[model samples]
Target: MKYIKLAAVVVAASISGCATILSEDVATVNVATSTGKKIDITIDGQNYTVPGVVKLEKDGQSKIISTNDADCASSTAMNRKVEGVFWVNLLSGGLFGSTTDSATDAMWTYDDYVTISCK
Candidate 1:
């Protein structure tokens, strides 16, 4: 009975791993034009205004940032790797959680620390 209880506790604890708590499916990127102008911007086809922060989903999807400024160019970035917390989940026998997150696009996260200058 003691061993069974312990195993159950362990299993329950492993169900919600670090990946679920340490990361998210969205990323925020700061964007600006070369002239520090607030211009129209498109990220992954989503329309937004630059000189602002944009929140985007991360799931191995490549984000193409574009602008219409004559002196600037577009930029692209990709979320191609699973977050490190996913590995923590794997090591903790939380494969089910990790797999669930991946299937739900929750496990695929990227650093939300990027400044996308349109230049």
Candidate 2:
């Protein structure tokens, strides 16, 4: 009887740990522009005005411009939720000789609910 109880306890602990790992919230956002034109971007209902000359980092690996109030809040929330890293990028055309003014697709991921905004 004691052996059976120990096994049951072990199984329960394993299941709980697995559940914790699976409960992390994560999401991704993709943005793209044409002609390298600057436009306002909205993610999760927040808006941000990104300049054509600025290249937003695709993942959390690069320096991020946290000037936007909403984007700053979102980043903070994400940092508290998941143990993994997130990314964001801007898709740009190959023209302009690798200039920041090129158009490109932007991608970003959040480990939890994030609000991004720019003005």
Residue-level lDDT tens digits of model 2 in 1-119: 99999999865543332212322222332332323334564433455664422222333232222433332322322232222211111122222212221122112223322233422
Best by lDDT: 1
The candidate maximizing TM-score is 1
lDDT per residue, candidate 1, 1-119, as tens digits? 99999999887776655666677657766655556766777877789987778888876665677767665665645445677778878877788777766676666655554445544
lDDT of 2 at 23: 24
Model 2, TM vs. native: 0.26
Query: How well does each candidate superpose onto the true structure, as a TM-score?
Result: 0.67, 0.26
Q: Local error of candidate 2 at 89, Å?
A: 30
What candidate 2 gets wrong by more than 4 Å, as runs, is 1-6, 13-24, 50-119
Q: What is the C-alpha local distance difference test score of each model? A: 0.68, 0.32
RMSD of 1: 3.2
Query: Residue 66 in model 2: shift from native, Å?
Result: 21
